[model samples]
Target: MVAMAKKISKTVLSRTDHLLEVRDFVSEAARQFGFSEEDVANIVLAVDEACTNIIKHAYQYAPDKEINIAIVRNNGTFEVKIKDNGKNFNPDALKRPDLQRNLTHHRRGGLGVYLMRKLMDKVEYNFEAGHSNEVSLVKYLSKKQSLIKK
Candidate 1:
């Protein structure tokens, strides 16, 4: 038999104050799915990073727009989709920073994308009708691949 998946979605203003609310949502969702604290933290971190990017680069600090977050868990896997009305980004356009050289020189930027790619099993971006953009991330929970070990 297949397990039932849980789904949750919400929209919040593209403002800094609502970042905490997003974290709370991730925590609650993880708990409902029987995820450990560390697992929950990882999920929250990924979400935070994505949201931070959306706020900083997507909307460019415009308070008039909104961001939508949707989370779904099924068969020991979780998928998160974040949507915004800002400019679209090509995930493939990002280049992995030269950690050896950049780290020594203290170069900034480009780390968020790398971190997101590391934390999530998959990250994808799409532009809808040339007006809205969506970023989706997925993480799987398995005995061998789970972030939380028994």
Candidate 2:
């Protein structure tokens, strides 16, 4: 049997206020691809964290910046690509916080990349030739292995 596929794309301003809109759009895309409610919720959460980081850290909540989000479902996998015209970043190099130090300081930041890695089957960052940067998040359907296995 031929696997099914779905694709959707949108661009939204990179502002903290638009984070909820981004989540709603991601949820709708996952729903259309026939993902379970639970899986769809996870996808939305991961994407939300990613966009939140982009808007807050990368773009610094710049109202003029734009974030392009592409949602695709193909070959039994759900994927989301978030492109931003902001400073490039290598999420791979992000250091995990020392839990002890964080607890001592009572810090409430720096968990976005970690959460994205935990929630998605594939988390990748791309620094293009120009100012555009992209973060790709993928989650497989129930039959696929969990991403946490490493």
Candidate 3:
């Protein structure tokens, strides 16, 4: 039998101030899905990075814009979909940062996208015409990462 998936969603202004609230929502959702503290932290960070990019890069700090986040968890995987209307991004066009070069040059950006890719099992992007740019991230839980009571 397949386990049921739980879903939660929230829409907030494209403002940096709302990051903490988004983190809180992620934490609560992860906890309910029986994720370990470490897993929750990773999920929260990845989502935060995605949201930060949306607020700063996509929306360009446009206060009137909004970001929508949808989180869903099924049997062994958790996923988050962040959608925005301000602008579209091509995730496939992004390249992984060279750690040595970036660290040596003290580069500030690209790290978030790298970390998001490393920490999550999957990361994808989709653009809907005249609708939204959606970035989706998924993480699979190992036995050790799950907090579910057997």
lDDT of 3 by residue, 43-144 (tens): 999999999988877888888788999988887788999999977766567678788887899876677788899878899988888558999999887886
TM-score ranking of the models: 3, 2, 1
Candidate 3 residue runs with Cα over 4 Å from true position: 1-5, 99-107, 144-148
Leading candidate by lDDT: 3
The global C-alpha lDDT for each of the candidates, from Candidate 1 onward, is 0.82, 0.82, 0.85
Lowest summed-lDDT stretch of 10 residues in model 3?
A: 141-150
TM-score of each: 0.83, 0.85, 0.85
Q: What is candidate 1's lDDT per residue for 53-137, written digit by digit as tens?
A: 8888888889878999999887778889999999776667768888887879998667788888887788888888867988888
Residue-by-residue lDDT tens digits, candidate 2, 58-104:
88777888999998877568889999988777676768867788899
* Clash numbers, per candidate: 0, 0, 0
- What candidate 2 gets wrong by more than 4 Å, as runs, is 1-5, 144-150
User: Model 2: how far is 129 from its true place, Å?
Assistant: 2.8
lDDT score of model 2? 0.82
Q: Residue 115: error of model 3 in Å?
A: 0.9
Q: Provide the clash count, candidate 3.
A: 0
